[model samples]
Target: MANYYIVGLSTIIGLTILSLLYDSFDMDMYNCGSTLRNLVVTAPHDTTREFSSKNVTFDIAGKQWKDVIVLVHIQKTGGSNFGRHLKANLMLEKPCVCQRGSKVCNCSRLGSEKEQWLFSEHSVGWACGLHADWTEMINCVPSMLDKFENARQKRRYFYVTMLREPFARFLSEWQHVKRGATWFSSLHMCDGHVPTKKELPLCYKDASWAGVSLDEFLSCPFNLATNRQTRMLADLTKVGCYSSLSDAETKVKMLESAKENLRRFAFFGLTENQVDTQLLFEDTFKLKFMEDFIQRNDTNAASIKQEDLTVEQIQRIYDVNAEDFLLYDYARDLFKERVSAMRARRKRRIPS
Candidate 1:
């Protein structure tokens, strides 16, 4: 975030004009007292724990997982790179719904259409992997484990996901949509925040953020800018779409559940630590990704420099993604612990 900046040179009246132009800005409408403050909320009581204490690492001695891996692909979190690696190293079965000559792959079915195809009728007897729909498959273990044929295969169902710093991800997503990324065109086609007609899809209607500036967009009630990682990790059925207004107990339970689920994952990686992430994959799955493989997508969307965002935008982003920040911290600690444990185990291999 050191490189990130906000262009915070606007006057109070300037902000007013920007808000009026966007039609949804209300940062000035808040009823705070004279002395403005930025309060940092502490993580939940249960947010901290010894990562090494969790028994989440899988035993791959027989490499039963060599054929089956499930990835929960979080957008803009180096998913393209990860998918590229998978395509290059592993023999993927083409999706059932996606025809052989189709130029566009529709993954709109519960956001796991690709994963659905992986387990669909057409994908049997293939050594491949699936990009899971996190929302539809929040109970990561059982949802993926059930896909395996038997107990032996179930033991090999590897689940992995990568997380990013929330603000960076949100900024990337905004820029991606702003630039009209081909993949996100479904939701990015609309020209404004609200659709003029009644027929637009919910995503497009809600995310028609075209005319709004970054600060203006951040000020609005943007769903994707919220604790997205937490939402994806959360068992939404159990907790039911948490918000700042949700009861305290409910949010705590959701956070606790998400952390527990992360522990249950075969491997949890970070976009900031892509090398380590790939190393974990190679070490766990026993496959080498080629050095020359194009892992990242080419994008002209410039990153939002931290200094370029207003104080309000920065605070808004932080406040909105508070849950994700905590989750990312926990995941970082877990990743380090798991990597250290792997190295220690390697040192004690006792060559036969």
Candidate 2:
């Protein structure tokens, strides 16, 4: 009787130890999986090759509700129109509530009015600074959200943006500047410090670069508008911010970094490809827009005739925006590939 009792006690103890070990192993695997996912999603990759869509997966609706969508609004990328669409056009279970004469809308989560799901100028009002770049957004957005919520919680951030053809975007920016539009309020925060006057001088002495000629616009070596898209999308810190702006090697690194970072973004749209942009956005987030996106060719930049410029002047424009031209080409190709993959996936989902 005593031997039988001892055997039973030993068996129970052995089973309890095995269960605890199994639970610990399971938890470890879960933590490991989370870490791996983060690494795959966020880590910088080779800029030479295109990334496969198979590895890029997201919990669309769940993330849209639970996580934050950060928009890196590059100027003259048709981002303003897209922002408006996000605020008013999206068909959602909990639509963003906007107030009259307000620049911002309440893009709160499903149940929480205070906790926001979308972080952009339209939703959060330049919370990271006026037209914050990728470097500034990545650094400021997470902490800003924590401050807004008055709590610290780990939340995934999905960054999105829109890209435009380099020449058109540059022309649009010039037109905007010509109309007295100045992004002078932009902090240009990088590496925990704004670029000093010596590091980044103003293109004009006046309050705004109004009525500036295209030649004058191109003449300013410090003109942020020259390669605006590349600079905005790149991690400036990698190229030593504005300090190494003139270095050829630095420009190369910045362009490469920008390409890699753009690839890492959750989604990006092309201003020229409105239909594809809308379809991709809808498929990406599992959310629909109330109306189809309309392609507007009659933009400020479109008004500028290429035939009006000399061959030399055209070459100069392309030379100045060389980095942006490369970046845009890369982005457009990637965007098309993703759109094709999305269409293929949709076809597969339909019943035979």
Pick by TM-score: which candidate is best? Answer: 2
* Tens-digit lDDT string for candidate 2 (75-193): 99999999988888998888899999998999887767778778899988999999999989888987888888787756667778999988788888999999999999999999999
In TM-score terms, candidate 2 sits at: 0.84
Residues 1-352 of candidate 1 have per-residue lDDT tens digits of 4312232223223433433453332232112222111110121111111223323223223232222344666677776566545543432333224457542233211233323222211233211223333434433334343444333232234556778866678777777655544232322111122222333222344445465466655654534545667756755555544233134445455555566667656566787777778777666655566663333434423344556866777766666566666677668887887787767766778685
Error of 1 at 340 (Å): 0.8
Estimate the TM-score for candidate 1: 0.59
- TM-score per candidate, chains pooled: 0.59, 0.84
Task: Look at candidate 2 and give me any clashing residue pairs.
Answer: none
Give the Å error, residue 295, model 2.
Answer: 0.4
